[model samples]
Target: MNEAIMEKVSADPFAKLLGIQIIEIEEGKAIVSLNIKENMLNFHGAVNGGVIFSLADVAFAIASNSYGQTAVGIHVTINYMKAGMFKDTLTATAEEVSKNPKLGLYRMTIRNQDGELLATADGMVYRKKEQFA
Candidate 1:
């Protein structure tokens, strides 16, 4: 099940476009990483907030849908604590906070290669009855 979910998430076009990779994934948990590229930086020379948010969102999506149920993010809030620089690797890990039949809550932390916290996010998803199969 985990393998299938990983494969499914790996095939995400947006993730592929941003070079996001799934480092690890299991039921209710996922870790993803991305290397900060020049194109990913903002005018201030730091990684764009949207890029960081997308990395976190990918982790959340993988964790929330690990159970094979189709889940879509309904709401999310993120806080940026530090900036990511070029050539730095950013990793985001997501863990389920709570889940029911209809909804799931998740928390995500984004860190740099040095383990410095860069951002955090809380997300809610609406789980559909349909399966990923």
Candidate 2:
């Protein structure tokens, strides 16, 4: 793991606000975790889909930008496989599938502590010339 990249991603305010923790990061991969909270639940009592998507998005963002380049999400699609309850620990792992100078593709999976699949997402990012230090 590069300390510079880790430090940059660690400073994200939205991730901080959601209590998302970055467990690991590599050139094209990242793992992040979050513990479900009461406020994150939807009216039906399950963890909100937006929260799950945000957790996965954070992983995707970190991995895509791990090279120190500025990367912005261009397209994303997610499928919810199961419901998450309060206190459930969710982890989202994102891996780079392919990339070029200007574009990158990634796949992310969200799972519960019990190792059950909660959601899967596919994302695309537009790699920019600017860099992150």
Candidate 3:
């Protein structure tokens, strides 16, 4: 991992606030994790959907920008498949599906520590001309 790139990803305030950990990053993939806390629960006691979405989004962002180019999410769709419980550790893995000069597509999957799938997402990003790393 490049220290500069890792530093940039780790410096995101929302990720920090949610205790998200950037586990891995490559040219077109990323893995992120989050330990669900009681405070992160929804009214029904399951982890909030937004939290799961954010985790997937972080992985998507890291993967899309892993090329050192500035990539911004243009479209994303997620489907929740399972409820996440408090105290559970969830992992999100993002993989690049396709890309062109100015755009990229990624797929992200969220799973529990036990390997049960929780959610899946498809994401698209618009790559900017500027490089961040």
lDDT of 3 at 3: 75
Candidate that would win on lDDT: 2
Candidate 2: worst 10 consecutive residues by lDDT?
Answer: 1-10
Runs of candidate 3 with Cα error greater than 4 angstroms are: none
Task: Estimate, for each residue in 1-133, the C-alpha lDDT of model 3 and write its tens digit.
Answer: 6777777887989999999998999999999999999999999999999999999999999999888889999999999999999999999999999999999999999999999999999999999999878
Candidate 1 deviation (Cα RMSD): 0.9
Q: Tell me the deviation in Å of residue 86 in model 2.
A: 0.8
Give each model a TM-score.
0.97, 0.98, 0.97
RMSD of each: 0.9, 0.7, 0.8
Which regions of candidate 2 deviate over 4 angstroms?
A: none
Residue pairs with clashing backbones, model 2: none
* Stronger candidate by TM-score (1 vs 2): 2
Over the stretch 1-133, how does candidate 1's per-residue lDDT look in tens digits?
Answer: 5667767888999999999988998899999999999999999999999999999999999999999899999999999999999999999999999999999999999999999999999999999999975
Candidate 1 vs candidate 2: which has greater lDDT?
2
